[model samples]
Target: MEEKKLNELTNEELLVLKKKSKSTKVINASIIGFCVGIAGYSLFVAGITWPTIFPLLLAVIAYKYLGKNEKAVDAELKSRNLS
Candidate 1:
């Protein structure tokens, strides 16, 4: 499908886009937090092991990707004077 430019989207569409962007950010953060909590529980309660590192790494990567997407959304909003 052809992608429409942000400027070409109607106001309602833009609002939906903005809401989705914010929701995605929240979801990513929640996942990262849950992972970190699990990793911590495994480390302190179950004892440290190689498997414990996996959740921590996953959380870090998720956080990094979330930041990148957030920057892109912020830039788009700024360029469009939407936020």
Candidate 2:
């Protein structure tokens, strides 16, 4: 589902978002960690190849994409004195 902009969300919705974001943060970190681990393993076993680079790149992209909404929600809440 497409999320409304943080400013457009109601207080209750913002609270819900705050809660959800916390959980999402944990999951996102796990995914990033796993991706990094893969990259590291490939680096050790194969050395400086696409397989090593790809997961590291994927980790960076995943970090940006996954945390995007959570960051916005946090800024919104802090701006509203709700955080």
Task: Give the alpha-carbon lDDT of every model.
Answer: 0.75, 0.86
**Model 1: pairs clashing at backbone N, Cα or C within 3 Å:** none
Task: Provide the global lDDT of candidate 2 against the true structure.
Answer: 0.86
lDDT of 1 by residue, 3-56 (tens): 346556666666677787778877898999999999998999778887689999
Model 1 misplaced stretches (Cα beyond 4 Å): 1-12
TM-score of 2: 0.88
Candidate 2 — worst ten consecutive residues by lDDT sum?
A: 1-10
In candidate 2, what are the lDDT values of residues 15-71, reduced to their tens digit?
997787778888999999999999999999999999999999999999888887877
Q: Global lDDT for candidate 1?
A: 0.75
